[model samples]
Target: MPRHDHASLFIPPALTRRRLLGGALAAAAVGATPGASVFAQAAYPTRPVSLLVPFPPGSATDAIARALAPQVSKALGQQLVVENRPGAAGTMATGIVAQSKTPDGYQIAIAPATVFKVPHMQKVPYEPLKDLTYIMGFSGYTFALVVPESSPWKTFQEFIAYAKANPGKINVGTSGAASTGHAATMRLAQRTGADLNHIPFKGGSEVLQAFIGGHINAVLDGGWAQVEKQGKGRVLLAFTAKRMPRLPDVPTAIELGIQHVARSPIGLVGPKGMDPAVVKTIHDAFKGALSDPTYRRYLETYDLEDAYLSGADWYALAQKMWVDERKILEELDMLPK
Candidate 1:
């Protein structure tokens, strides 16, 4: 993925707690009367904010978070620090954010769509929809089914047919159990009635490695833009509603007669019990950041599409995704015992 230039948006080291608090108090005093300003300086994020990525540092989610951090920090006039806390298929970091002491907008998480799928596969401490305040939905990357260019299966249908005939002989790679890749593979198996074997890795890079090393027959993973560009593999199909502009030749799952699309949409979120005012402030900042030209360029470079949504809209989508994921997991017999 392309790294966005953050020099222009870098937070000054001179930004101190005293200055931030003083600015907040002044804004509060000025806005003591109702209907003062939506961008009231005292509303929320009185200090540096931390955005947690529930995946390892170089993962797609982590890259997106880092790309948006400086822009968000500039928009909010506060430093946005990104912290990696990968474990338990993202539940561990999400659990930490859900249980954190700060709901004042100082702490937030970059939530992946996989968070909705994980609960069906294992015990999770937080409800995907109810335990967090959805601040904004920014961008999403499409999942791709990739195999070596020399593989015998040329198209998605061929791969499905081969898998059906071979049963558990064909192995597929995923980032982790309940990841978007994993859920998508399971759903594909259920839809096609193929008894394929799944091999889980810690991240997309590893999944690609397994596929290249011939340890896995195919990889159902994100970062297709990166993988396909490497020239060693070909994308069998995209698990998206439409063909990606960069990969125009690749067919989508829908185009291949499947009714599902599994892009890993990510967004900003805070722990439950956040003040509505704080949520609004954070949402506005991220919304602004999403529109920044630099950010837009980053999206295009990574073959990611912009899917901006407000807090309410994102929350509704999250709710629907949770329900839909549960149904799919149950149908595939992947629900936890």
Candidate 2:
């Protein structure tokens, strides 16, 4: 059966009566757990919870996870230790959490859109719908199309014109192949008929290093903050729905006649089948951590907003993304043969 021709291939048509009853019975079984086990569920994270960051320490995702860990730990009466496990554009750690036999709330990872979209593009170790438990969404990155300060193209239009005229001469760098930055760059190329050569690195720091060393013409990433701060690059366009407040002078993709916005939000998730009680405990703690002044200040520093969503809502969005990403990848000819 073709996966993209119909949504039914991905979404179940309807819940059968037997399946509904089975769900109810499963809930009853959870309710039927011994009082001691139930109490233990309420007292989740008696030990430190290890929060996995699927990127390097200097990356934006790692910074966000570290910023919230201490406050979430305070709320839960347990420490939240952040561990970096960077590889495959964040799939390495995400796959670890997904393939783990343990569903205890003690181990969770920060999930990005790649968690949903990557599985559609290639064979991954885990399934997005069945292998991971969506926890709570907290924040998003501010992505931009940045070029070196010495580049002659001052505006996005000039850059696009140059890319179109020169074809593959425009070497663009991103965190990794099939990353949100790569996807957005490809979308822009498709929209503007520009032939861009995409160079993928393991993380944003590497991409920045390469861009600064004149190895690439530009990079699409959140690390634009560091580049712009140091006056090493000029931000020509923001891959967002609206003009970023901090970069009000910079036009958005939409304003530049490209009808695309990079909606790459970040969230938390654990292995599937986590106890509902424990899920709630972690969710509530992180939800409260959203208000932490330090985390909020981090958001302000990076031109991001507090994009919070409940677990159920995040799961629903992932379902939509599963279908949407297949279409996007198919259009880009990125799906594995």
Candidate 3:
């Protein structure tokens, strides 16, 4: 009986090489999906991470990424690459990142408030409000109205007066037709009888370029402040209720008796199903970056606020805004339904 018991100690003859292969195949099948790897998130950022900017290089959005990238990299132990995939008024790149299946915290994007309305406006790839996971809030655009330095209009009043006297002669450029800038511009025209000829461009950079080249009389964009700061364009009025800090001398639309604003809140967004822990890690890194002196300096330099919010808070705000913006989009005749 003891000799017979040696069978238990020896390898079972039934466990042939083919059986071993079958066992391995079974294990691999189980490991195919991310859920199968319980510790996948705990070991994140094994390689360089991308911070996708939905605007061209030298843009304010691009500036945000570049300013915070080094600090975020130091916090995460990996390089946070600022990659620009500019097009479609900052939606093309956003859609690319939102639809990304890589949930390992390697791909994320800076989503602007325009995303809220863009989807309802027309058919797009991703539903920004639901499709992407909001990570944290960042600074918003300080939209303003500016004219070339050599333009005849010296003040906001003069511009409006001229517009009233000359109906469609005032040509204005914006990021796009349905862009926040364009919408704000149109709202201004509707309110003040500007009758501005709105010229839509692909991005704010183009709007600014056109304005600088004297292709347009005025440009309604966030980049207007930079042009004013650079002494290229003269800011006539801020679209917001308050004057932009960088252009403190400039009058607000409210001060000029125009009740309007064009501030577009922006935030970080990743593909759906991102691990909570990974999101928290990214949020904390960005929070730290927002607080960094250099980054803050950049924000101030660009006339931007460090509007950082916790991941939970940011998501809540996005959801609430989604509901609010839907109504506005509908009123603007930009709803799918």
- Clash count for candidate 3 is 0
Clashing pairs for model 2 are: none
Cα lDDT of candidate 3 equals 0.73
In model 1, how large is the Cα lDDT of residue 164? 87
Cα lDDT tens digits for candidate 1, 253-333 = 887677778857777777765544566667767777776776676666556778887666776677778788788777768
Model with the higher TM-score, candidate 1 or 2: 2
Candidate 2, residues 1-337, lDDT tens digits: the string is 1221111112134645565455434433322111111112335678999998888887777777889988899998999999998878767777888887877788988887877778777788777677777777777778899999999999999999999899889999988888888888888898999999999988777888899999999999866687777889999999898888778899999987887677777788887666656776788788888888888877776666678887767766777777787787888778888
Report the error of model 1 at residue 210, Å. Answer: 3.4
Highest-scoring model, lDDT? 2
Q: TM-score of each candidate?
A: 0.80, 0.85, 0.83
Name the lDDT value of residue 60 in candidate 3.
Answer: 78
Off by over 4 Å in 1: 1-46, 212-214
Could you give the C-alpha RMSD of every candidate to the true structure, in order shown?
A: 9.1, 7.0, 12.1
Q: Assess candidate 2 and give its lDDT.
A: 0.77
lDDT of 3 by residue, 206-306 (tens): 77888889899998887666787788988888887676655679888877666666768888888765654566677778877887787777676667766
> How far does residue 91 in candidate 3 sit from its true spot (Å)?
1.5
